[model samples]
Structure formats: C-alpha cells, structure tokens
Target: MHSSSVSGSRPCLHSFKTTLPLKALAFSTMMLPLHSINASKATYQFDTVVNQNRLIVVSVENPTTVFDKTTHLHGFGYDLVRSYANSLNVKLEFRTVKDNASALNMVKSGKANFAMTTASFQAIEDKHLAGFSATCDDSSVLEDNGLNVNLNWVFKHANDPLSQNASAYICNTKQNGTISQLASFYNRNVVKDESWDIIQRDLTNRMPIYKASFQSTAETYDIDWHLLAAIGYQESYLKPNSVSPTGVRGLMMLTHNTAKAMGVNDRTDPSQSIEGGAKYYDLMLNRYSNISYPDRNWYALVAYNMGPGAVSQIQSRLKAQGKNPNSWINLYSYLERHKASNSRYGQATQYVTRIRAYLEHIKSTPQLVNL
Candidate 1:
C-alpha cells in the first residue's frame, strides 16, 4: 500500500562510465533471515485470496518466454508483481505448475492469487474464469492465429476479491524506494545465504575438474570463488562446450568480442573462459563500487548479462527520482515499472537473481571451504 511518485522527466547520467573497484568484500557464507518484526501486531480485517502475510503466485518454467528458471521468479512480470507485494509488506510464494492452462485453473479454484506464466488473457481457452492486469510491458497483446504469441500479462481469478489489489499494485504508477532508503517502512528481515550441501552433491564430479580454476580465477579477480562458479553454472551449466544461441561460447558463455577483449583465444576452453569472465566481472564490480555490499555484486551480474550501458541507464533513472541508484531492491521496483523495452530490465533482473541463488547455493557447500 506504500508508494512514491517519480518525476515525469527522465534524467540522463554518464558518471557510471568511471572506474570501479577491483576488489570487494567477500560474500558472507553466513545465512541471514529476512526481517519478521510484528511487535505492534496490527491485523487487517480484510484478507482476500492472498494470505495476510504472503502472496501466492502461480507460474511455470518458460525461460525465453516467461520466468527464468535459474532465478526462480525474477522475470519482468514476476519482478513487477513481487515489487507490489513487497510494497504491501507481504512475502511472495511462487507456485510452479505444469502449464498456463493449469495456472489458470489454480487461480479459478482459489488456490493462487494470480496466474502469471506469461499468458495473454485473450488467448486463454476460458476467458470468463479470470481477469488480467493492464498490460505494463506492451501496448497490446499480440495474437498468432487466435493464440497468444507475443505479449506479457498476469491474471487473477475473476471472483477473487484481491484481484483489484493485484491490478492496482501491479500497474500502479509509483516510485520504488532503494534498499538503503526503505528502512522507514520496510519491516522484513534479511535472509542469510544457506549451505549448499545439495549443490555440492550434484557437482561432485565436476568439482575436481574446475575447483582449481574457480579458486585461481576468484583470487586473481579478488572475488568470491562461488560467484565465478555460479555465473558459470547459470550461463552454461558448467559445460565447457556450451554455446548460447546468441553466439556466447564456453563454460562462462563469453561472446566473441568479449573473449577477444579479455585476451581469450579459445572461448571453448574452460580455464580460459573462466579467467576471462572473472576478469570482466571484476571490472564490472569496480564500475559499481559506490553501491553497497550484496547490491554491488547484484548490479555487476546484471551488467555482465545486459551490458554496463543498460545498467548505467537504469542507475541514472533511479538518481533522477531522488533515489539511491546503488540499491538493487530500489532499482527493481523502477525497473519493474519502466515502459522502455530496450533496457532489458526483466532479463537483467532475472540474470542477477539467478546468479545470486547459485552463489548462495555454492557458498552453503562446505566442500568449497577446503578449496
């Protein structure tokens, strides 16, 4: 329910092009819990389909078309909706489903507050069951032979009392506060990184091959080893031969020009790619050095995926709104609502979220300590 207004005129900033820190505080392995203070304990008389303290978002994995699986719920739609929930001081609970049809059924059945698996309301087989929020990412939905082809939208059960709340919050025109600035109203606790015993179990075989390279690269770049490994896992799942559809190659998915710039001759070489990506990541970190811990790495990862220019533009926008552009959570709210398509806000946010999830997983792994 909390909100702020952004100025209509967008300001441009070029200061982000300056030098960044080559070193950063090592990411803490200690896990922290999110804020859960309810000392005053004010209860709301009206509790809609959404839980009083949480929002249940139904979705399915559709990386290219919807939510990025690597990051869980960090896509454009997810970010936008989640930001709204956060504004209301509610935690988000994402429910994975088999498909959009099933997602709609969940909402219709009152199981979830909304169905947000990149479905266009117009294309739904049963349109009467749900209503969609005003499309934020585009002007109108595109139809390919009467089926949703291109358009991003979310839906809630037509009968759900919280549907209006969902609509108002999702498409609400307001300024999102930066993390550093949110102490005024943000009451949630911060969650600490968890142990990655599960990830280590899965990576047992590959650890022997890449552990040394991960350690060496991390040291050379003055970054956490797990970060490098997390990026590798997200980009190509630690497969040295992996190549992205856009021509990014190798374990870290370095593009041709990026590889050359980093002095990498063989993009497919695991060691070489890891080194190059690490160096590039370190450089990115330096650029956002002014940003605080956690957020610094978050911005760097976004820059690494979407390029520094896009992130720079985002920072500038945040600054124009009298916000701390250095705060990722603050930026997430703005990025979620931004109308511009070129910024790649959705993809960049998702990329960072996924990298963070992986980093946390790796940090939790006790085996990494030995390396």
Candidate 2:
C-alpha cells in the first residue's frame, strides 16, 4: 500500500505488495512504527519556539535609611523594575552588599543586573558598571543636633547617557510617588480640627536654625543639609542647649554610647555630634533592611526611641492585631495602646510621637529651609 502526500509534493507513505494471511496483515498494521507519525504531528502542533525572558538582578549596598525610604515609601527600585519586567515579561531580583565596594563589584562582575545605592559616579571609574535613571539623594541627621544632609545621586561614569537618563526618570518617579503616599497617609490620620497649615506656621517660626552646608569635612562629614535639619527638628528642635532626660545632649543629642560607637569623643561638639548622629542613623537603617519602607522608617524611629528589641516586641503585638507590623501608623497606634499599660511601651510611645510630630512638621513646612 502507498499513501499520497496531501500537497502532492512528496510521498507520505510507502508500501510493498505481498501475499499474506489476514491475521498477518492485521499484525503488520499494528506493528507499524508510530514514532515518525507522532514526531510529524508534534512539528505541526508547535511550529515556533518561544524564548524565556532574561532576569534582572538589582543590587544595593547594606540597606540604609535612604534605601529604606526608597523601598518602603517608594517601593525601593522594586516598583519600577517590576513594572519594566512586567512589560517585558521578565523577572527581577535583588542582591545587597555590606558596603559600596562590594556592591560595585557585584555590578562589574555581572552578578547583579544593576547597583542601586547613594553612589556617586565621579567617585569611581564608570567603565565597569552602569547606573539607572535614578539619582538617590542621601539624607542625614546631625549628631549633637538633628540636621539634614542631602547628597545627590552618584553614578559610575560622567559621560554615560543611559545612566543620566535613568537617574532623571527614577528621581522624578520617586519624588512624585513619595509626595503622593505621604499626602494620602497624612490625610487619613490627621485630625479634622488639627490644621496642617498651623503646624507649618509653628515650625517655620522656630528659631536657632542651623546653616545649610553641602561641603564634606572632618567635622561636618559632608552630610545633606536638609536631612540634618530634619533630624535636628526630630531630636531636639535644633536647640544646641537641648538635653534629653536620658542624658542625650547637644543639638543632635548624642548619647554617650551612640557617640562612642560612632567614634565621637566630643559629644558636646556640634560637628562631632552631627557626624556621629548621621553615622548612627545609617547604622540603624542598615540593621533593619528587611523591614521595607514606611515600615522601615517606622521601625527605625522606634529603634531610635525604644531600642530595636522593644520594637520587636511591639511588632509582635502589631502582627497579632492583623495590622502590618512595619507600618508607622500601626506602630504608632500600638505604642499608644500599650503606653498606659506597658511602661516600656509608654517610653517608646513618647519618643516616637515626638519624632513623628517633628517629621510631619518638617514635611509640611518647606519654608523652614533655614533649619
């Protein structure tokens, strides 16, 4: 027997004529090879091959307050990278390093798809790694006084257009997203009778403001001015003579232990205090990297006030309440609920509330720029 090709271009089957018993003929038909037939059917069924999308790994230095803010408040670079990956139908991964050098190496070795840190390209050679469209503004608080340190995004190369473009887009997106989230959160919690405008007015009226400086020095540590001011407002209202009941002293209010950890011998010196405070906050932020933003920030504040261990206990309580353990609001509410009954909780609440109020005041009054 022979079978004709459907298109008549080629023979589909071949057969040989032979004298055979009906039983033999049935056996031959049954034993005919089916592998070729299955292969042909499969070829027709799947005419094209689809390639898997490549995965991107974004790396960062040990999580700092800035990274916390970006991740928690702005969804770190995750939101942006995720959106891009979704569009391309790819996957995004994150890797973190203990320091800047390691983070750079990750990108250079192609172990990471990109590096996201408060890195300055001018500080390093640009040939090995590429930065995205985002420039991170590093915020720091003074040691003796809470002051703001603002640092701009740093990239690996000065001439890379891709890095520049990525930096611009990221900055804009972060700014818009942060503003929106802050506003929404504020509106939800703010009392109807408490005017944000009045809060702004009071903050603006506060005096003894620190001078803004962007320069790096042994004394100043080259922190961003605004960040320092924000810290100052939070810690002690930028009052150089301010002293916490716990003996944290100076404008940035450096505890003896905290100052010692940051290698500050002169806790009373404004410059030393600021540097120590900034470094300490950086350390605290790095310690809580897994906490995610808004929560990261919340936890950092809690750690700053009640200590990390106490915050952990509060987090457990928050988890029990079906609230996000990392949210500032939930933490704040929990602190309030526990303050009356729990001595440790009461102390933590007092500290956290003060910081929250100061942060809110700073956010509302841009005119307090002098501070």
Candidate 3:
C-alpha cells in the first residue's frame, strides 16, 4: 500500500512516526479495532490512530513517564495516548521499551506504533536516526508519510538508569488519573483548601492595607497585581514589619543591598518594597524575554529568588545540551535531574510554586479584593 507522503520535515519534539515498513507497522498496530479501521479510514484518507477501536503506544519507563502502580503498564506516554483514545472511544494497549535505542527500535521493528522516551533530543539525534525538534515548546508531534504519530518523547537525565526496572526518574502521570489530575500532580493545584480557613481569613483581612501598593506597582510594571500580592504574602504575609534571618526585610523581602540597588530608601516600607520588587521582577522578565508565557513568568520568579546570574548560567548549560533554556519547565527539569549547587533549586521551586498557588488563591478570592 502506498503510504501518504510528507513534504517538509520537522523534529518531533514530543512525538514522531517511522518510515517504510515501520510506518506500515505503526498503522497496523495503532488501528487495531476493526470497527474503527472500517468506519473512518476511508473518509479520513488516513490510517486511523485516534478514533480506532484500539490504539497502541510504546514508551520507556522513566521519570517523565506517567505510570499507574495498579496498572503498571502505562506511563506518561500512556496518559497522552489515553487522552486521544478516550476522546475517540478507543481501547489502548501500552507497550514498554528498554532504552532509547530500543524505544525507537520498536518503531523501526514495527512492534509498536509510536514511542515515548525521556531522553534528550540531542542525545537521540546523536545516537539514533535523524529527527528535528522544532522550537522546543512543551511537546512536538512527529509527522511521517502524512501520518501524525503521537509520540511523547520527554527528555531524560544523562545519569538515568538504562532499564525501566532500574530507573528512578519521577513519573508525572498515572494511568488511573485524568489529564487534569495528572497536571495537578506536576503544576500543583493553586486553589485554597477550605481547611486553612482561619489563616486565609487573616490574610484576607490584611490585604486592604497594601493592596493599593501592589496594584500601582504591578500596573507600573505591566504585570498582574495578584502576582505581586502573592509574592508579598509569601515573603512576609504582607506585613511590612517582617524581617528574615538572612536580614531580608519588608513585604517583598529585599536585602539592604538589593533595596539600595532598586533605589528603595526603606526596605520595610510596603510601597517602596512592592515597587522595588516589581521593578526587579520586570528586569528578570526582560532578561528572559524570549521565553514563552507562564514558563517565562515562572522562570522570572526563579530568577527573583535565585538571582538572574544563576538562571542565566543554567540556561547556557541547557542550550549547550541542545535544550531550550528559555523554558521554565525544561530549566526546572534540568535542575531536578542535575543538582545545581550554585542555585537553591528546591527552595526556589517551593518559592515559585507557592507564589503560584497563592496567586491562584487570590484570583479566586475576589472578596479579598473588596477588603
């Protein structure tokens, strides 16, 4: 059978399909349900992968893979494939690969339709066949012979174990949970828990005093006021009298030197502190101007905590490794995989993550705005 042809080639950042027999095998494996193959293949003019009665996806077990302990078969790749399978009302068959070579070999050998590997694109490019990863956003799909085979290739650490059984990489998804649930596992649910009612109420009461400062400073910086508010709350519960053991003072917790650098005469003054912090944050955002949204904001928060110089160094290292240094997710992953002694990855992660959570909470609590 003559397979559909592809004109331009792009690196499959998140996913890819094979050529020749491998392509044929992918179609055969992915379009398992007879009903689907018979029902849509003719109209779509493509071998059914999404709406097929059965969908097959192959991936190696690693940190980025989403696996369910109860099911033990599906990982991150499974979750991604499951989303399509669920949407198409199809059944999914999850397959495993031993290593990067073996994972792609599944595609080459026709045992699996598509594969997911948490190995770096550069490593894959160096070791395996040719494939291009375009732009380095979240995930890139592989297109072959006009077939978009959904491959979830999450890059892995260099020191990660060779075998799934031996690997200790953090799998971010589980077979039992929905996509929202999986996302929550990684990004964390920012909403406030009702259990913290008293603390939240106290914080809500204190919002009015500094709300204007946050609003004005955030507006001046063209930033979300809630973000500044969240940072203020996290730093000192929005209290101007607060001081840290490290001698950082004020609602935004700037050290004496940083306060001077930002032209703030009083670090303990809520308005000056908020303005200085916002100005400093604006600087970080400008420095990482090329990074995309949400990720850029998250990276800026990291730079705010760990300093821009440290983040810049990490970004350079990421670029050297053929990864996008502008991506907060990629940077975080790199930091997690390769421990950074110069930067406080854990502390910074918590700081940014908590601020995000607080920001979400504040956004949801419009009543707090009234206060």
Per model, how many backbone clashes are there? 16, 41, 14
Error of 1 at 90 (Å): 28
Weakest lDDT window of 10 consecutive positions for candidate 2: 5-14
Assess each prediction's global lDDT (C-alpha) against the native. 0.56, 0.47, 0.56
CA lDDT, candidate 3, residue 171: 21
- Write down the lDDT that model 1 would get: 0.56
- In candidate 1, residue 320 scores what lDDT? 95
Best-to-worst order by TM-score is: 3, 1, 2
Please write out the lDDT profile of model 1 over residues 105-163, one tens digit for every residue: 77656577666655554544344443443333222222211212233334432222244
Tens-digit lDDT string for candidate 3 (154-199):
2221211111101111121222223323342234333345635854
Minimum summed lDDT over a 10-residue window in model 3 is located at 159-168
